[model samples]
Target: MLYKVVSHMLEQEAVVEAQNSTQAKRKACRLWGVSPSDEWHGISTMQARKLTEKERRVAAVAIKHRNICLHTDEGGSTVSIRNTATALSVINQLIGTDTGYFG
Candidate 1:
């Protein structure tokens, strides 16, 4: 009976995972500059690793949103803005990368 309960829980978790993946795929599809749905849908284990790398890259760049700079002007070029890094990260996430540095 305990085994059956554990098995049922595992099955339910799998179902939830599938649903989450589907939702993620749909979201990725809606995003114009994101990976194609085909790439995310029915993803293989290798592809899952790739996706994880992408997510890490995104997270790394997202750190820039908290950046604060001291400049004569608030919106001056002297102020460091990491927008480029963020964009690069997003692009890398959209496309698979060979280097695992993103991880």
Candidate 2:
């Protein structure tokens, strides 16, 4: 959710993200210098948008990648694919983009 810190009297606004509505509102109150009774009201929650299939898949790949270095490397995280671009291509195909890149 997006927490909006809105000051109607001062015409000021700030935005923040929190796990739940209450947390967002509280943060917004502090940010906009409002005490829940001030004429300058602050704190409004907006619903967050869900990620699409392509965006989710792209994010998943961007988050983690295998250590595809050739030869015996000292540190290796995962030994799945051989290269990052190759893996991205394969993931794109599975996600229906088929751009051969992180598209």
Candidate 3:
């Protein structure tokens, strides 16, 4: 499928440029003749490895509340779980990490 081809190109770019995941994605776009304005809806496992620092920060913040919930007003346990779920959803939306591993 298209995903497999793009993924292979991305990996090749990574090996060629010695770049990380994010860079490889950009490279793949170029290889596929995709413009920067193009909207990408999925993130392969490679992309997850390349997540930008900003995304990583957001994901971390999203997950942090879960730990906080363990100590503070544990009464809001549902709220904490909700936030984490929302965070996971956002991450999945932005980058397809195939979090099925969590299950």
| lDDT (Cα atoms) of all candidates against the true structure | 0.31, 0.44, 0.39
Q: Which candidate leads the pack in TM-score?
A: 2
Arranged by TM-score, best first = 2, 1, 3
Tell me the TM-score of each prediction against the true structure: 0.28, 0.31, 0.27
Off by over 4 Å in 3: 1-49, 67-86, 94-103
Query: For residues 3-27, could you state the per-residue lDDT of candidate 1 as single tens digits?
Result: 0001121121111112345453333
Q: Write the per-residue lDDT of candidate 3 for residues 3-87, one digit (tens) a residue.
A: 1113432343211122454554555555546553444422342342433455445456656754322123333333243565465
lDDT tens digits by residue: candidate 2, 1-103: 3333344555544334456655655655765566644443534332223334655554355435543222224543333655554554444233332333222
Say which candidate scores most in lDDT: 2
**Which pairs in model 2 have colliding backbones?**
none
Model 2 misplaced regions, further than 4 Å: 39-103
Clashes of each: 0, 0, 1
Clashes of 1: 0
Which portions of model 1 miss their true places by more than 4 Å?
Answer: 1-19, 32-61, 64-99
